[model samples]
Target: MAETYPVLQEAEPFYFEGNDIGILVIHGFTGSTQSMRDLGEAYAKEGYTVCGPRLKGHGTHYYEMEQTTYADWIASVEEGYQWLKERCQTIFVTGLSMGGTLTLYMAENHPDIQAIIPINAAIDIPDMAALQNERETRFLDAIGSDIKKPYVRELAYDKTPVKSVKEIVMLMEKVRNGLHKIQCPALIFVSTEDHVVPPGNSQMIFDNISSRQKRLVQLDNSYHVATLDNDKELIIEETLRFIKRS
Candidate 1:
C-alpha cells in the first residue's frame, strides 16, 4: 500500500458560507491556506461566503511541489471560484504574494470578478532571469516564510523547488503583461519592509494596471506575509471598507 500522511491542522482548507457576496482567498507559492485563514474567517464573519483552497503541491511534502506548476495552482483557484460562483451573486478574490499574482490573473481573465485585493503581489523578483537559467539544482532556499513577527511562522516547504520558482517567474511575467486586461477595481497593499518580495512588485502592478479605480496602501510595520504580521488588523479593516464601497 502507498504511504499516506495526514494533513496538518493549520494546512487544511477552509470554507464558510455566509452571504451572497463571496470571497475567494489564495495563499502564497509554498505556503498553505493557513496563511489566509484569518482573513477568510474575517470576511465570512462579515456575512460573506468565503473559500480558501489548498494550492496544488502545497499543504503537503516539498517533493510534491516539484511536480507541480503555476498552471496547476491557477486551476485550483478556478475550481474554488466556480464553487463560489454557483452559490453567490457576486464574487471577490484576494491573495498574498503569488496568491496575489493569481488574483490579478483571475481578474484579467474572468471579467465578472467584482473586485480584487492583492497584498505584496509578486511581479519581478531579483535575478529571476538567472534563477530561471539554473538547471544543475532542483531546489533553492525557501523564500515563503518571511514573516517578521517573532515566534509566528508561516507553514511552508523548507526548500523551494527551482522548477516551481521558475514557474512563478513565468507567471509574474504573464500577469504583468496582461495587467491591461484587468478592469475590476483593485485595492493593493505593499509592505515596505518585506524581506522576500521587493516593494517594486506592488508598484509595478499599480503602475501597469488599467483599472481607473485603484488604490495602493503601504504597510510600514509588517513584512512580506503582512496578513499574519503586525498590520494584519489594518489589512482586515481596509479590505472590509473597500468591499463595502466597491
Candidate 2:
C-alpha cells in the first residue's frame, strides 16, 4: 500500500508579466512555489518579468515525489527558463535549498545566464550515512518550514520520501562537481541559524565556484527558509541591487 496526500492550492506556479529582464524563482525541496512567491512578486513589482515554477511532483503530494527523479525537477526548471528566454532579453535565476542547487546547475550549463542568486543552497547532506542505512523506513519527518518568524509556516510536504532524498543527493553531487564551471555573477545567501542545511554549505559554494563577482551574505536573523523569515526584506533588497548592478 502507498500513502496519499492532497494538492495544496497555495503551491501552484505563478508568472508575472513585466519588463524584458526575466527572473526565474525556484523553491526548495519538499516545498512548492508558495515559498518563493513573495520574492518573485517583489521582482515583478520592479518591472522584471517573473516566473515561479512548481517543480514536478512537488506542490502535490510526497507520495508523488517518490515517483520523480532529479531529472524531472531539472526539466521543470528548464521549461521555465525556455519560457522566459523567449520573452526576455536577459535572464536571472534564483532559488532556495534544492532550488538553489538547481540554480547553480543552470548557471553551470547555461553560459548566457546573466547572473545567479542561490539562497541557503544545499551542497552536502550531513545525515547521508544515516539516511542510507534506514532501509525499512520509506519516509521521514518533514524538513520543511524551518522559518524563524512567528505565526508563519512553509507550504510543504508533511513527510519526506527517502527515495526523493536520494535523488536530491545525486543532484547535489552533480552540482558540486560542476561548481567551478559556473562563471556568472553570483549573490549567495546563507542563514546563520539554518537547521536544515549546514551554514558551511554556503561557504563551500563560495569557495568552489569560479565566479569572479561572487559574494556571500550572511543572514543573522533567519533560519533555513529565509525567504519567508524576518530577513526576507533584506534578501529582496540586496537581490534587486545585485540584479541592477549585474
Candidate 3:
C-alpha cells in the first residue's frame, strides 16, 4: 500500500480582513501557504486585507504535484485576486519564487493591479532545457526549503517531482516572454546568496520589465526562501514602505 499524506492545518489557506488595500500573497512551487502566512499576517496587522492561497497540488504531497501544472497554480492566485477585487478598491500583489513569476504574469494581464512585489521571482532559469530532458525521471532532492537561517521551516514537499519541474520551466518561459508587458510599478527583492535560483534570473526580470517605477533590493543574509530566512523582517518592512510610497 502507498503511504498517505495530508495537508497540515498550518499549511492551509488563510485570509484576514483589514483595510481597502488588499494584498494577495503567493507562495512558491512545492511550498504551502505556510511560507507566506507570516507575511500575510504582518500585512493584516498593518491594516491591509491579506489572503494567502495554497497553490494547486502543493502542501499535500509530491504525487499530487506530479499531476498538476502551472495553469492550475495560477488559477489559485486568480481566485485570491478575484476575492480581493470584490471587497477592496485597490489591490497590491506580492509573491515569492514561482509566486513572483505568477505575480508578474498577473501584472501583465491585469492593468488594474496597482503595484507588484516579486521576491526572488523565477522569471528566467538556468538550463531549463536540461530540466525538461529529465522530466521522465521520478524525483530529485527538494530545494524548496533553501533558507540560510538555522531551524527555520518552510512547508514543502520532501522530494521534487521532475515532471512538475518541467512545468515550472514552461511557466518561466511564458513569464519571460511577457515581461515587457508588465508596466505596473514593481518592487523586486533578490537575495545575494540564493542557492535554488541564480541572481541572474532576477537581473533578467529587472532588465526586461517595462515598469517605469521599479527598484531592485538585494538581501545579504538570506537564501532562496528569504521570507523564511534571516531577512524576513527586511522583506516585510520594505514591502510596507513600498506600498506607502507607491
* lDDT (Cα, tens digit) per residue for candidate 1, span 1-246: 323446667998889988899999999988999899999999999999999999988888777888888899999999999999989999999999999999999999999999999999998887664698897998788877678789888888888888888999999989989998988999999999888888998988998888999999999989999999988999999999999999
**Candidate 3 lDDT, 157-185, residue by residue in tens:** 89988888899999999888999998889
- Among these predictions, the greatest lDDT belongs to 2
TM-score for each prediction? 0.96, 0.97, 0.96
Model 2: lDDT to the true structure: 0.94
Candidate 2 residue-wise lDDT, 1-246, digit = tens: 555566689998899989999999999999999899999999999999999998998999898999999999999999999999989999999999999999999999999999999999998976852575567889989999999999999999999999999889889999999999999999999999989999999999999999999999999999999999999999999999999999
Compared with the true structure, the alpha-carbon lDDT of candidate 3 equals 0.90
Please give the CA lDDT of all the candidate structures. 0.91, 0.94, 0.90
Answer with 1 or 2, whichever has the higher lDDT: 2
Model 1, stretches more than 4 Å misplaced? Answer: 1-6
Model 1: per-residue Cα lDDT at residue 241: 99
Clashing pairs in 1: none
lDDT of 2 at 33: 93
Error of 3 at 230 (Å): 0.9
**After TM-score superposition, what is the CA distance of residue 10 in candidate 2 from its true location, in Å?**
0.9
